[model samples]
Target: MTDRELFDTYRRDVYYLCHYMLHNAADAEDICQEVFLKAFQTDRQGVERIKPWLLRIAVNMCKSHLDRRKRGVLKELKHFLLERRRDTEAADEALERKENELETERWLRALPVKNRTVMTLRYIHELSLQEIAETLDIPPGTVKSRLNRGLRQMRRDLGKSNPNLKGAECLE
Candidate 1:
């Protein structure tokens, strides 16, 4: 496929993957462009699955990006964002949105990077276990273990934070 076609077909996938991993729009956009630029430079004739290959690249890029920075600041920023009350037409809807945001942030904070990436691939991106393995270049069993461990950890973390929170139901 041409560069434009490749980009158009998978930009959202790539961007979201990066955004979810990095938790920053500007960083995700930068990484997404870098992913496509690298894609444009590489020979695609040998790549059988464009989406997975692109995602693998994006994943590696995000991991590297994460490694280069201190994570404390990002967590602080996210916590700050979650603390702010939004102005909305529907109080119930706003409450639900804020709840979801806080839940997501908690989940993200609870898991390690590897486990978080696995969870994101399985839950958010909706990739199968096998696909996650290939995208992360790990075994399928590893992917399953990561998911299980992440869910368990998240459940414990959520439970500790809120007595009424149904961690397993939300996680599963």
Candidate 2:
């Protein structure tokens, strides 16, 4: 497939992955653009795959964006204390879902960046361990370890106040 065609097919998925990682739609769009731009610049010769390549680019862009964002936030005490509020209203079911999602986000925020990336790729993107390893350029064993550790941390976080939280899948 041509670069444009290949990237077009995966754009939404890539954007979702970026959005999940950055937690900001604007940053995710920027990262997605960077991913596609990098793909356009690279030599595609001897390349037997496209999705993994695009994902690798996307993941690197996400990490870089996160790093820069971290440094920027560190420089401002007032900005560091500010929180981004969710804008959506809550229905009964929506409220429950949002609560669970917020808790998951809290858990995710507590883990190391690498482990959080693994968990997002594994659970949100629904990528296989092998696919994740290839995309992240890590060994499969390392992905497994990060995933396990992230899950354990999430479970501990969820179980802190409510034992019933353990009965539901953390992602739910």
Candidate 3:
């Protein structure tokens, strides 16, 4: 496909994937642009599945960006905390829901990259186990183990913070 076609077809998916991975809209946009630029500059004549190919590019770009700077999580937490203040202007119910969502995001952020990626792909993006394995270039068994470990960690963290949280026991 031409560059324009590629961008039109996959721009939203790429952007969301980057945003989900990085939790920063501006960085996601920059990486999305870079992903397409790289795709355009290279030869993709033999690419069989564009979705996975593009996603792999996005994943690598996000990993490199994270590795270059260790403070990304702190920056994102700060951004979320600041954003939470803005939510206070909304209705009480909405504010409560937003808080819960933010709390979930925080928990997800605490996870290691591999676990976070697997969970995001499996739950948020609703990919099958096999698809996640292919996307991450790992075996399905490894994906399962990482997902189990990640969930256990999240449960442990949540349990320590809030013993009454409903889903902590479900993680067992």
Q: Which has the greatest lDDT? A: 1
Among all candidates shown, the one with the greatest TM-score: 1
CA-only RMSD, every prediction: 5.0, 6.6, 5.2
Model 1: per-residue Cα lDDT over 5-35, one tens digit each: 9999999889978777788989989999999
Overall lDDT per candidate, in order of appearance:
0.79, 0.73, 0.77
TM-score of each: 0.75, 0.73, 0.70
What candidate 3 gets wrong by more than 4 Å, as runs, is 1-5, 20-24, 41-48, 68-93, 165-172
Q: Using alpha carbons, what is the TM-score of model 3?
A: 0.70
Locate the minimum summed-lDDT window of 10 residues in model 2: 73-82
Candidate 2 Cα deviation (angstroms), residue 172: 8.4
Model 2 residue runs over 4 Å out of place are: 66-91, 164-172
Candidate 2 lDDT, 41-65, residue by residue in tens:
8888866667777788897787788
Return the lDDT, model 1, position 22: 81
